[model samples]
Each structure stands twice: as C-alpha cells, then as structure tokens.
Target: MERAYKYELLDKYIDQELSDKERQELDALMTEDEEFKEEVEVAVMMNASFNVEQKQRWAKLLEAEATKTSVQPSQPTKTSETDTDQKETKVRQLQPRTRWLRIAAMLLPAVFALFLYLFLANSSQTAPQMADHYLSNRHQAPTITMSQGNDLSQNWKTAIKAYQEEKYESAANLLEPLTNSTNATAEQHFYLGLTYLYKEKAEPVKAIQQFEKSQQLNPAQYSAEGNWYIALAHLKNDDWTKAKPLLEQIVANKDWKWQTAKEILEEQE
Candidate 1:
C-alpha cells in the first residue's frame, strides 16, 4: 500500500513512525522514485523524530573518518622523526670509529717512516764492509823495510850493540844521526827514545814523542810496548797526570809487560 501511494507515507517515514512492513515497502518505492527519495531524505533529516540509532551511528562514522583524515598528515611527520632519530644514532655510533680510524691512518705512516729512517741510519752507520775497511786501515803495518847488506854499517851495528849492552849515551850518539835522516823509519824513533830512557836524559818527553810517531806510522805495531815505555818514562820524570792513561793502557794489555808496568804504576800512585 505504501509503495502504491508513496507520497502518503513520506510524512510517516519522516516522523519515523512507519511500521516495519510499511518501512520495507517505502524503501522499495524510494529505490524507483529518485525525486521522492530525495524529498523523504531531506524531510527525515529536518524532522526531530528521525531514527536515533542511525543518526548516532552516522555521527560516529563521520568522527572516525575525520580522525583518520587528520591523522594522515601526522604519519609522514612521525616517519620523518623516526628517520631523523635513526640517522642521528647512526652518525653518533660512526663518529668515534671514524675518528679512531683517521688517527690510525695518520699515525701509521709516521711510525713506519720513523722506523724506516732509523733502520736506514743504522745500516749506513754500521755497515759491515765499512767497519772492516776501517779496521784494516787502522791496524795496517808501516812501509819501513830494513836494508840487508853484507857489509853492515859499523856505526848502526855499534849503536845496536851499545843498546843491547845498556850503554844508553853511546847508543844515543850513534842513533841520533840515523833519526835525523829524512828516510828514518818509526823504528829509528823508537830506538832513539829507548836510548834516551836508559840514559835518563829527556826520558818521558822523548818516549812520548817516539810513541806518538809509532802510532802515526802503524796504530797496531809496537803500541803496547810504546805505551808501556811512555808510562815508564813519565813515571821516572814524576809526571803522574801524563802517565795515567798510558799506564792504564799498558795494564789492560794482559801481556808480560803488564806486571812490570803495573808495579811502576803503583809506585807512582
């Protein structure tokens, strides 16, 4: 009946007073009547007695949709905040590792360079070949050869014999001419000094001069004997200050001369 007379039920539908069967019939009529559906929908909205549950449900749905729409803008902002926090944490975590790696990178090269410099310096300073060369040069014997003759110079032989007999002045007189010769060897200076020592004339100073000459010719040759005799000469002259180093060298030799040199050194001390 409501569908046959749809306009008659409009008031009752707006008032929300239609029976369940009549409401079903009116809904079916409204589906086919576009103008009538619009009229009824407007009237029901204006009516004070519209369906309370439907109004409440529609208000709740609208509020939920508003909340969803409002929250959409904030979602991106929240994502950005989370991303920023994660980035900050990552930067913080990486900073110390980066700093330490930079420091290590800087220091590693310096340490390696320093080590290399030291190694090269030591290698240059202490080269085995250089050391051997220096030792060979320092210990080399002097180029002074004795001339062999069937008729030996009687003056030289007489001086040598006088030295063997401990006749120091006679030997010195004979040896002086040979020492004055430009061709004189270090051995001539040594024998001349021994003559002066035994004669007790210019003992320490003469011995010191001859020892220094021997060292200049050959650092290794007669060094122990020369040093010992120099110390003995200085001791005889009572020059303790000059004698000490030579005496010390003589004592360190650990040879047969050491005992005699030590005894002389003790007497001076």
Candidate 2:
C-alpha cells in the first residue's frame, strides 16, 4: 500500500501539487532509489504528453466554435417570400458541411493524443541510452602537473598510468591510501575522486565527498575543476537540483569547462 501511495504521489509531483513534506519525501526516494527515479521520469513525460493533448483539444474546440459562428445565417436583408426560399436553401447546403466539421473536431484530438503518447513513450526509452553516451564521452581524465620539489611518488605515477589505461579500479585502489596520508595534496584527492567517477560501476556520492575535500584544501588551484567534477557527480546520480547551481557558477565564471557546463544547463532546461 505504501508503494502504491508513492506511485500516486508521482502524479502530484508532475502537476506541482505536492505539499512541502510530501515533496521532500518524494525527493528522498528519488535520490535513494533508481527505480523511483525512472518512475518519476516516466510520470514527467506522460504529463508533457497530456498537456499537449489538452492544448490540441482546446484548439480544435475553438476552431469548431468559430466555424459554427461563421456559418450562422446572417440577419435576413428583407423579409420576402423569395428571400425566405433562398435562405432555406443556404441552410440546407450548410447542414452537411457543419456536421462533418463537428465530427472532425471531435476526432482530431484523439488522433493527436495517440500520436503524442507513442512519441513520448519512445523518447523515454531512449533517454537512458543518451545519458550513458553523454557521460562516457564527456568524462575524460584530466592531465596533472607537479612542481620541481613536489614531484609525485612512484605509486602516484603508476596510478595515473593505470587510469590512463582505463583501469579505474586499479587506479582507485592505489590512490585511496594516498588520500588518507597526512602529506596528501589537493591533486591527490581530485584524481582519486575522478577515478571513482570513471570506474565501471561509478560511485558518484563518494566522488562528491572527495572533490569537496579537494576544493577545501586548495581552492586556489583546484576550485574550478573541483566544482566541475562535483557537478558531474550530481549529474551522474540524476540530481539536477544540486548540479544546476554548480553548472551555473561555472558558466558565470567562464571557467575552462564553461561551454560544456552551459550546454548541459541548456539541455536540462
């Protein structure tokens, strides 16, 4: 029953009719449950389809009303027997046309609604594929540089090599211990976070934690990249609310990733 209730809440959410507490509950579920998130996505698409259908129906109704008004017999110019005969003939001629118009007006909305539903259903099926492609294409490993006295250890070089070779799990294992060391730098934490993002089974929330730590430790050096990765982490989880502010900040700063961030924001909108 609770599950059924949550499903019903999706409709209220799409309609923007949920109360504050209910909205919070739904948000939590979406964050924690992938299935719930997909359900919400479907609900949103269906709501868009219904909105289109309603608009089409209204347009058809208005057209039908306009046709009816236009076809109303004009006031008789003169009340004479010959004029009466001509007016009767005109009404007879219009009756069949008006009937056909009314029938078309009633049928068109149903036809449009069916088409919209099929189109939206197909789009929903393809959305996940599109998201996967975008993520895979956009998330390239960033290059790293070290100062003369601050050269990275052999382990760090090996980790970097592993990451470049697409062995993200191996890279993450090597970097994990480095992040916990007292001498760990912001760069170390940033790359560790990125490995989590690139791994076959990503851990986005974990990536966000590490990226936040990296930003805090060396805001001057890693701030822009940190913000970009954090936004990507949230995006990976389908948490647009958290990602949007970060993307907006990147765009406003005209940062290195500003163009990509702007494109993402536009797509979301």
Candidate 3:
C-alpha cells in the first residue's frame, strides 16, 4: 500500500540508503510537514546512536583480542632443543590467528573512521539545505489584519489584496510609498519587507532593512518577528555568521519559533 511504501522510503532515508530523487522528495516533505520532520530527526539520532554502539562493540572486541595476544606463556630458563622446537611449533601455529586478528583490528578502525567522516559531512549539508527550504516556503505573503477606525490608507488595503493574490510586484510597488513616507507605521514597514521578499526579483537586502526599521519603530510589537525574518534573510543570502546570533537569541528566548531556530542552529553546527 501507499502507506507501506512511505515507511519503506523513510527507512531508506534514515539508513542513508535513499537515492538522490528519494532524498529530495523526503527533504521537501520534511519542510512542509512538521511531524515528518520530527520523525526524520528522531531517525537520524537513532542511527547515530546505533553507529556509536557498534563502534564501542568493535572496540571491546579489539581490546579482548589484544589482551589475549599479550598473554604469552613463560619460557623455561634452561630448555632442551626438543622443548625449544616444541615452543617454536606452538608459536607458528598461533601466528595465523594472530595475523587475522591484527587485520580485523586495523580494518574495524578504518571502517569506524569512514562512518564518522560520512556522518559529519552529511550533517553539515543538512543545515544549509534546510535553510534553503525554509527560505523558499517563507516567501509566501503573510496575512494582514487591521483594526477598525485605523488610519490605514486605501493603497495599503490594495497592497494587501495584491499580496494575497500573489501579485508580488504590484504589492511591492504599492507598499513602497508607505515605506518611504514619514508617517509609516511599523506594520507598514513590516509588510513592505515581506513584499520585497515575495516579489519575483527578490530584494532580500532591502527586506532586511525594512524589517530592521520596523523593529526600531516598535520593538515591543515587532522585535521578535523582525529578528526571526532578519535571520531568515541572512540565511537566504547565505550569510550564516549574521544569521547565527539572531537564531541564538530566538532559541534563548524560547519563543514559539525557537524550535525551528534551534533546528537551524543544530544543522549549522
């Protein structure tokens, strides 16, 4: 059934055995589905734990072999030629087993090292890939709400309608005037920033500036959201250093967005 196929795909993903196409599909699902994302996280953690356990098991086996090899029989101070020959024969008989053990010990460490290198490489790639997905999904226009009797202009209303309709160019053009106006509200500035992000010819740097202005105008209302978007903008621009501090702040605050921020930070590490 379809459900069984999905489970099998997930198993392949966790084992790092998925083909490129399958991996891409899974990555897309992870971005869109929170439960699926959490499942993948758990799977990765379990896989890493399993690898560690196997490494420990191999280490113990190697140690036991080493201890066995070290325990040689004591030789007599005065031994007959026949006794020496007998000892030599015994040593020859053990050499093959000892050589095989040494080979196994060397191969096991190499195998562990290879696994470690692959895990680290894969982990490093996961964060940047997730960031890309986050940015792509985040470009959708945000819902706009207004209070009754507010001073919002007709142009602002039109801009919101345009954004909702995915007419990002028109939305950006309409919001531009409000952004430049002296009496612009923090909400206007924030929406303008979102418009820039959604526009076809995206202006992420401009978006960042507008978001920053919004935060300055009304930190109490816009600070947390502003910080989150600014960090996302930096990520979209591939400026991880700039994004890191903002994500850390979100994580420290333990806000609603903290879980996602923490995941991004973990990927970066």
User: TM-score of every model?
Assistant: 0.41, 0.49, 0.50
Better of 2 and 3 by lDDT: 2
The residue-by-residue lDDT of candidate 3 on 138-210, one tens digit each, is 4445455566326667888888889788887998899898889898889888988877766676677998999
Q: 21-124 in candidate 1: lDDT tens per residue?
A: 98998988889988878888777776754565565556555444333433322222236778978766776776675565555545565644433333222223
Candidate lDDT values, in order: 0.61, 0.76, 0.75
Residue 133 Cα positional deviation in candidate 2, in Å, after optimal superposition: 4.1
> Which candidate number maximizes TM-score?
3
Residue-level lDDT for 117 in candidate 2: 41
RMSD of each: 53.4, 19.5, 14.7
> lDDT of candidate 2?
0.76
Shift of residue 260 alpha carbon in model 1, Å: 3.0
- After superposing candidate 3, which stretches have Cα over 4 Å from the reference? 1-129, 136-151
User: What stretches of model 1 exceed 4 Å from their correct place?
Assistant: 1-152, 200-202, 253-256, 266-269
Lowest-sum lDDT 10-residue window in model 1: 133-142
